[model samples]
Target: MPDNARRPGTDSTDRVDRTDRAALRADCASCFGLCCVALTLTRSADFAINKEAGKPCRNLQEDFRCGIHTDLRTQGFPGCTVYDCFGAGQKVSRETFDGQDWRQAPQTAQQMFQVFPVMRQLHELLWYLTEALSLDAAHPLHGEIRRGLDETDRLTRLPADAFTDLDVAAHRDDVAGLLLRTSELVRATVPRRKKRDHRGADLIGARLKGADLRGADLRGAYLIAADLTGADLRLADLIGADFRDAQLSGADLTGSLFLTQAQLNAARGDAATKLPSSLSRPTHWDR
Candidate 1:
């Protein structure tokens, strides 16, 4: 193996930018592991040991190597596998800084790590735009998606030095608005909505357990405080939709389109229910 590992499992999770899956995997391999050095997490289900931002884990060996990667789950570090670097991480580490190791820069590592999250947000927008273009039903939103993609691409080229000053949450909200439009266009033909557009509708406190929501368009819809236990969400386009405070227990979300683990993590769900393979049930939901 090369000093940099490139296993099939090693490909950066770029589903947010679901274009050219193979190229996206290469984009991940091209990264210098900004995630490993930039992020900090306390010991928990996801991470076996506490790691501070800018401080490399004891298991992270020299030359960007992980000492127990193959045995991460057994070694109690399965959380690493669940995290996605979105392609910006390695680029900022290598391309932005010209391959200067964070360990060497020392003073700049924290700022670089901080920027990793910002870049991930931009890349996620790029991912959403790319996927929107791939949808034949969403032709009406093509121009908008292109515009968003162009802007997000520019975000990727920002100076790493400026990342520390970025307001990423606000930027994410802006792009999220357009992504919502694209989702509506894509699901316009789905039969579930009837004449009622659920766009931005509040479905909170509804009794929807075991409902078949297949092929539904749920862009930015508020599902808070809803009981969705056992609801079938297969093939539902759920971009920017709120699942917060929703009971997804026994909800069948298999094959649901465009749903990320981050979205699921922020929601409440049950263990007997199915979820995207990438996410585990929240501890609160396991009870």
Candidate 2:
């Protein structure tokens, strides 16, 4: 399972308010260790061992807590630390299943596992839609965003059997179109001369230290290990941009669109890294 750890909210200067995002965050204590058992863990730099789907990790305790929770990175499970189900675990574990754990009803284990990923995707859409609705620049599309949010939220509450045949990809496509429109509206606030488009660009290990990337379209960009130190990413559309091992020390990400904590967790940063008030400074950052 991804850590999805919570931090205190800072001053508000971003798109979405923290209070509105409380339910979007993962609450592992209220969950049934669904991520630990339902997801697969391939042996890699991110994982210490190979774990098949639906099998509890060896470190998972009887109480649904990770035995090595405090030292997952040192234990070669860094990948687990960067994952966030957007609060889908507890929704599926408690509300969907009515607090009946898989252990208590072994017959429902596989069904619950199947519904989890679907719910996670829905929750992720909710996260994005919520953020989109909060953007003043996207005000013209607020009605549409609200409809999308309500429909996505409704899909999340569907019965377990409904998920088996749900066409989630189609729904995601519909939501993605709306988000693209929202991105266009928000990024238009930046001057045309300052806008850059790097959508789906391969920027792995690129040296962008002190680069000016304001209002850039970086959606789905591969920024793995990129030297982005001191880069100005304000108002950049960072949805789906992979920040794995990216250096963000002294970088400014205030008002960046669709940036998530999981991406920040995978990157390296320092005290000088400026983030939106909605995000927390990763504890692993250099002090």
Candidate 3:
């Protein structure tokens, strides 16, 4: 199966990451290279080489860095740039064993490696929960998000020993429910106009290819079957816009604010469609 479920942090330098990345960096560098030693990878579309968990790659530098840092994409290792440790690697390295490189304490190496995935999963939860709080238009979800944030924070603060023993998957279910509700609340804010006020609205398939949807407020608009190929959707406020069965092939939604993945999944598009990074092209369009 394709690793379609990407852990958050695509735009690692995006606003959400920038806000707290300094703190993460501080905590991570003190790490004893846990991520380098603990994770495993298979040669796949994203990863160019395979690595065993706990065994550092040959290209790993003396400072526990990737030697191909600058030319990741050019050097056929784009996956490294795309992957975020979610702070787990650092936490394990520093807090788990007092920053002692597992190489020195060979007996603890196996246990540290075993706990790496668990901490990675918890850190991923923190990433999602943190992002959920930053959406300004998601006021309705503010309270629930705070709770999730608090819980995520608590888990992230666990010392290395407890972190290693964490049950990551079981904890995810609790947070997933809150995240789903948060998505609903955010999307619900998009208002449906009474009289199809789709002026400048970027319809996905209604013969609107190459149309202009600037300054349009398409709250809950049923855009299914609208042809929005090559449409200009920059600065469009598409709150709760329905994209079910919409033909958005070649459409540009990059600057369209408030567009959610759930909305995109409900819509129809093909391989010919150009989507925002936040959203994925529907699989039916895959060759």
**Strongest candidate by TM-score:** 2
lDDT ranking of the models = 2, 1, 3
For candidate 1, write residues 1-287 as lDDT tens digits.
12232323333432223345232221434455666667887898668888888777888766677778667767887667556555566657665666676677777677777777777777666656766677777787777776666666666666777777777788778777776666666556666555434557789778888987876777678887788888988757777677766888889887565676556755678677787553356554554
Candidate 3 stretches greater than 4 Å from native: 1-30, 193-287
Q: Model 1: runs farther than 4 Å from truth?
A: 1-29, 192-211, 217-234, 240-256, 260-287
lDDT tens readout by residue for model 3, 82-111: 455556676666655556767777888888
Q: Name the regions of candidate 2 deviating beyond 4 angstroms.
A: 1-19
Please state the error at residue 175 of candidate 1 in Å.
1.2
Instruction: List all candidate RMSDs to the true structure.
Output: 7.2, 5.5, 10.8
- Once model 3 is optimally superposed onto the true structure by TM-score, how far is the C-alpha of residue 18 displaced, in angstroms? 12
Clashing pairs in 1: 16-127, 17-127, 31-90, 32-90, 230-250
Please report how far candidate 3 places residue 164 from its true position, in Å: 4.8
State model 3's lDDT: 0.61
Q: Return the TM-score for each candidate structure.
A: 0.67, 0.92, 0.58
Question: What overall lDDT goes with each candidate model?
Answer: 0.66, 0.88, 0.61
